[model samples]
Target: MLLNLKNIYKNYGKEPLIVPVLKDISLEVIQGDYVAIMGPSGSGKTTLMNIIGCLDRASTGTYLFEDEDISEMNDDALSDLRLNKIGFVFQNFNLLSSETAQENVALPLIYAGIHKEERNHRADVALSKVGLQDRTTFKPSQLSGGQKQRVAIARALINHPRILLADEPTGALDQASGKQVMELFKALNDEGVTIIMITHDASVASHAKKILHIIDGEIIENKQGGAA
Candidate 1:
């Protein structure tokens, strides 16, 4: 298993006001699997994604990545896992406004201590993969909504992460641009990049091979389908 969760639980606060988000949740994702998490707001989908990406720990329960227990790892270890193993594409293209596409994509490698030349090389290759090779010098402010999200995708891919975690990746784009982004995701998945996308749109969720429906903090359905 590339990812596994066992009886994961999350709660906020203490005593009478404690709000439990996930209740005895368990899940597994294998290599090359394209999974989509579907749910309405407040259904713990984001919390589940955070735990899977190692951005947050489960309040209780075990999380294993490639059979190693990550729930007990230190902050630095989790940070390393996040930086080297997982890639995140957010709904809001989280690019630095002042930085060019290449610079923003190079940020992760910089943190990894890669040399500048190699960093730029990797960033350039990732940009090329996203079909944005010509826009390497453009800042986020100068790009269209679709282009900015593609830049974010390039930044996420620069590290060659094992898993791609996208949160509402097309939410900010118009229908046409959103379809373009989804096409990119499909191409990436065909090349064996495991993806776990979170979205409320059924049309968007159709892009994955597996659809997991969450309701009231629990997984209520698991559907298998082709890409949209």
Candidate 2:
């Protein structure tokens, strides 16, 4: 299994506003699984994604990644895990405004201590994979919403992560642009990248092979072979 969450729980605080976000949540995701998580607002979908992505720790229970328990790992360890193993695509294009697309895509490789020439080469290759090789010199402001998202996707792919976690990846694009992004995701999944996306739109979720419906901090239903 690439991921395993067992009886996970998350609480905000200790008082009246102490809301329980996830209660006894258990899930397993193996390699090559394209999974989508769907829920209404405030239904704990984001919380679960945070936990699964190693961005937040569960208040209780175990989180195992590749069969190794990561629940007790320190901040540095978690950072390393995120750097070397996971890639993230956000709802908002989180690309640096001042950086060129190629530079932004090379940032993670830089942090990994790769040589400058090698870093640029890898970033260029990743951009080519996402069909953004020609836009490498453009900044975020120079690109359309879909193009910006493609840049972000190239950035995510630079490190060759085992899994890609996308949160509302198509939220900022128009219908056509959103379709393009979804198609890119489908192509990536077909090439064996494990993808986990979070979206409220059923149409967006339909791109995945599996859907997990979350509500009231629990998984209400799991459907295989696409969205219901």
Candidate 1's residue-wise lDDT over 1-228, tens digit each?
A: 999899999897799899999888888899999999998899999999998999888889899999989966899988988999999999998999989999999999999999999999999899999999999999998899999999999899888899999998999999999999998998999999999999877887787899999888888988896674
Angstrom error at residue 162, model 1: 0.9
Off by over 4 Å in 1: none
**How well is each residue in 95-157 modelled by candidate 2, as lDDT tens digits?**
999999999999999899999999988888999999998988899999999999999999888
| lDDT on C-alpha atoms for all candidate structures | 0.91, 0.90
TM-score per model over all chains: 0.97, 0.96
Ten-residue stretch with the least lDDT total in model 2: 219-228
| Global lDDT of model 1 | 0.91
lDDT of 2: 0.90
Q: Could you list the CA RMSD of all candidates, in the order they appear?
A: 1.2, 1.5
Index of the highest-lDDT prediction? 1
